[model samples]
Target chain A: MNSVIFKKELKRNRKNTAIWTAIVVVFTALILSIFPSFSEMGEEMAKLMSSLPEEYAKALGMDEETWSSIIGYYGTYYGIYIILLIGIFTASTGATIIGKEERDGTAEFLLTRPISRGSIVWTKLMALGTLFIIIYGIQTLSAVIGLLIFGEDVNWPVFTTMHVHGFFLVGFFTASGVLMSSFLSSKLNYMGPVVGLIFGGYFLNAISMAVEKVSWLGYFSPYHYLNLTAKNGVLELNLITCLGASVVVAVFLWISNKRYLSRDIVG
Target chain B: MNAIELSSLSKFYGNQCGIESVSFAVKKGEIFGFIGPNGAGKSTTIRTLLGLLTATSGKAEILGMDTSNEGARIRERIGYLPSEVDYYSEMSSKELLLYHAAIYKVADAEKKIQELATYFQLELDRPIDDLSYGNKKKCAIIQSVLHDPEVLILDEPTGGLDPLMQNRFFELLERQNKKGVTIFFSSHVLSEIQRMCDRAAIIRDGKITAVEDISTLLSKQMKMVRLVTTSVNNIVLPVGALNHHQSGQKHTFDYVGPTQDLVIWLSSQSIIDVTLSEPDLERIFMNYYQS
Candidate 1:
């Protein structure tokens, strides 16, 4: 009921959110700074690509010939890593924002106010959603700046599409974190599930590349939707899959709210 | 109307124990003190009344509405302060109060926050992380009562305060009570309750062992008595009517029966000096705990 409380919660976490955004921006700048020099070293990378097996090339999201190109490097290497980084950071922050209060014995104070428990949970979720969007915006802006500085001939639509996919991935991961936080009381308890999901998804995607027969495994990971190499070097918008994942997030949120409202805050 | 009521209320945590078969009612304009030692279910009962925990059996009603069914409505009119007050350390006292004010839909929230900050002499700009424990407790107390709730439920509200702050806290409660707020506070500090509560329930091991007017509870349970005799020969006292210890030629007894009956019975003994004293809450509390 109290919308201002939601804004204040977002403000409370603003410092950490800004720190993460700055880290992402700095990392992007550092990666882009090395791009223009890659042209001079293209021959060396081509030789390295040639020495690799076909499965390795595909797993790395590269073709043997294009492995040396800056665009291919960004799309295949930096793009996946950046997406994963965003997902991991967002999920960790989102999951802890609400759960940490409980763990620290602060939930009692918050709940004793005239606000309803459902409203508190909803406000926290909204605050996390706002932080996720802000982080995504900062990352997208930093990428655009990096592309401009590197003097790359960028396709605006393609660039925007890639980030859109990243946005969905980040959102899904944030929801996953919130869902996990509802079940986990301590930060330590959350680490195992979170690390398992991120690394498990990446490894599953990698395994799908090595064994063609089990290539379907990639579809199970949110990382699969982050394939910027396909669709003519642009992100392919998978409406059905995105919607399915969104539905999953919604269901998780509903369960989290219901569970939170019903359970006694023992901490 | 009764401010709050619980009938056969019970709560359990898995296989562990919580409150069991607890029941009491607080009147609309009384300061009701819940006295108990640690883990005696005082907090559990308060949480159940606030609808923060579901009762495994029986019923709890607040403002004539079922606690579970109308918890939000009940919360809207009730102010609560938990035993341990924790807040977002990054937020300033002003920010925290404003946030609570918004959630509570307090009228003229900014003004209300300022008024509370001024009343408590709180530093509005200082971050919560930097404040001392007593200051943090003040912030929590101010936030809880800022909305001018109809009922106030405070758990150990003055746990960490200095004597001056504790006295000021009592003054604040008295002021609120004057404004017709129904106060239900839990404390292990007997003197605080003695000075503030109109009625009280002494709880032990999750049960309300005694619930009566504060004066009646103190008068009936607390006592001081002395007896003297010329001969210290074979002086034996009644078994169930009194609890006593003797020194040289004097005897002292404490009990919960009528003083006249005790006086008359003592008069029947050999003529000597005699003395009687009223009960103190500390002794009554110790007896309740031991029982």
Candidate 2:
């Protein structure tokens, strides 16, 4: 990979990355910091959970344990908001990272540079990975600090499993964004489609979980296989799902690189 | 060996033609011009040569390397100035130039960037989006040459420059040429071609009509003839004259043959005033178009 291009790409996305990272970390802290109040009223909150409609409760991944433990409480919101928020940022950024050059008429300047297209794509991907890690790392760190400050006898294994699943979920969404951008026109506004893809996947799983009649719909969403919430205060990472998703991400990146290499740099 | 060579290079957009069967060669250390009107496939050929667009057929070679296979290596040794200037809007000129230099791995890039910016009288601190079109063009020019490339491919390079900058640009080009840099200059302005190019190829409708030396194009015996006769009388037309026009006592036409024949014919007329001059490159270009 060309370091010059990689560095430039990273610098180009820095502001956007910062804005999204701030939002994610703040959201993480807000959710985690509020857990203390919820745990204090655990008995009353369990009664409230029972009073809620069973279908709606299942759809949202809320249960009796949700109010009893910080990890359980955070897991419900983490899947619903935190992972989705991070996914949206990464997916949208991934969509535009390469196509933005073509849309801005700067592809002529870049493609004519003394670097192979393979190197260009690889470097940009590296930049994308770096951005992903920065946002993801900071948000996770914020979660840990928030838990330390607000919780007692935290379920560390459940928390780790939920985060591992969150990693795969966000990664799959990011790769999907790269693949989608490769197939679409460079001039397209990709935010709409990127948001739709990530949210749509979540809702598919949610809807199938809430309705037993259409449980097969969950198969189509990556969230179904990569469980983002714990059951009975326990969550375990699925090795096969992680390995399969890695293969899919690799395929997606390969296809994106191939598409980029053959595209004409038209102004 | 030729500095640049195209062998029947063609580019087609689906079934539509961008350029077709175009072939030319630029000798080492020569200023070769590519002349064509707007939408005449000039940019298409240049883009194909730079490997921005894949050729439908045939091949291109630069400095003994095939462009399709060795584009990155070939680009390392070449500098290209596009007809339109489009750069990263958020970057200042200094940042953009530094980035470009970094891509090429140029040595002493900071000093070179400053020198070129001074020569162009450009403010390096201004963001690209805030700069005027001419200023952007200047920045483009600076980036194209900052690497001190062995070959320079320029397309409509002087569109936004003032007369003074244009002169400086030409002077710089001449200096580079003297240093054995091969320059491929593309423009629709025939005078620029006539003034700077040793040879030129005229393209029309995606095909090269003629490739001639500058001296040969000037020596074609084509002259714009205007005669103010003493009276309205029958004037014997020269055989080589074309597009003759008469308004009152004045008669004008393009004379394409021997100068002696035209002089003899002029002596026979009852002329009050007569003038003959070499036509501008526009008329010469039109002659090729018409032929």
Candidate 3:
């Protein structure tokens, strides 16, 4: 665990972290600000949402019953955007962290230093994990602050569970990015594939949710497992998709370590 | 103890060959040169020695530690300067230097970095992206030697520098050699090898053709001789005449024998006229290869 490399990575990506954190938090605050209007016209909004096609509503992952509840409202609307923003953040971060050394022609310098390949990978990954924690911390803080300022009543347990489940989903894409970065020889070349995977999983989740025959497609996207529809849902630490996503993250990190350690490192 | 040793080192990229059967050893306190043309496995050999690439069939040891299994430990006392260098675009030269120094755990990293920066006349505060290629090369030089490692591995380290900077860099290396640093220099520049190295290995087509003292090898430089003889067939060709070519009344070939003996033999031939010139690296290698 090299603190130097870890801190260096943190400092290098601070700007991007700041930008994404702001996007997630500001969006969270804006949605929470509309809680008053939403509660006042709750029945009308419920009719409008229910009258819409079930397919459209399911594709959008919208739950009309949860529209009046503060935490449920937060999850249905802001939760989707949160997952999307975190997806972009984690994917790009994971892909670029280690590969930028190779792309920028500095791997020769870094690898030649008195550091083990495992140490380098773990340190960079640690920094990446730290970034996620920081972003998530800021996001949760913003949501709680918004709830206090605008909402009549807030469901703390549901809100916490929503953010916690969102972490696992975002983590899935971040791990894919890490694995993708290990194979990339040039700068930002893997961004297309990583971002594409995130969007693909998102669409697959939508398709599986709206259609009855291919519900397995929902498993592809970690976003599908979020507790967005469960009003005042019990905070469960264990979910099958969460376990599956954790395994995927561990597998990618392991592969990234192995591949990077034994890689030929051309150019 | 040998500072660096490689035995039958081979690296294959799938079916393609990177380097094959490259064997050499550099004694402590010596500057050994690895010479070869591009794609001749110079970089491959160096990369294998550094544990940047694993060997398919052989073994390498640096400071008595196996390169494959003991890379990090071996690198503790090794300094490497690659042919082309790039660092974080956002990092100023000073920051990058400090970061590298921290990796090596240099106690007085700032002072060492400043010393090298001063000698190279590089702007330490400038971002790497803003620096010119030559300036970047200067920083790389500083980075490689700042820790004063016991072993220094440099691959074409003078590519972007001007003649003046090259001289300064060589002088710095020489100074380090005096302090007992082993230098492994890989380059295609014969003149540079002649200028600094005590011994050299000539590699071509992924094989080492010769490893000899630089002075002794350079002293035996191959010479090309062309003779316009009255009777080419009647004349007796001296020993070491190679790759003979005949056209009408003219005979031309390369010679790698005693210059005095060649002059005496030429005096006896009924030669119309004769011309002698120094041969290039290929011809020189051929003379050594054939012998």
- Categorize the docking of model 3: medium
Model 1 bad stretches (over 4 Å): A65-70, A155-158, A187-192, A211-220, A231-235, B105-124, B223-243, B246-254, B257-291
lDDT of 1 at B213: 89
For model 3, residues A72-183, the per-residue Cα lDDT tens digits are 7777765567777877888888998888888777788888888888899999999999998898888888888998898766767667666777888788789989988787
Residue-level lDDT tens digits of model 1 in B54-127: 88898988889898778878888998888887788877888888878777777898887777778777899999
Clashing pairs in 3: none
lDDT of 3 at B95: 93
DockQ of each: 0.62, 0.83, 0.78
User: Chain B TM per candidate, please?
Assistant: 0.80, 0.88, 0.83
Ranking by TM-score: 2, 3, 1
The positional error of residue B116 in candidate 3, measured at the CA in angstroms, is: 1.9
**Fraction of the reference Cα-Cα interface contacts (below 8 Å) that each candidate reproduces:** 0.67, 0.88, 0.79
Task: Spell out the clash pairs found in candidate 2.
Answer: none
Model 1: per-residue Cα lDDT at residue B161: 79
For model 3, what is the alpha-carbon lDDT of residue B192?
Answer: 86
Comparison by lDDT, 1 against 3, better one: 3
The complex in candidate 2 yields a DockQ of 0.83
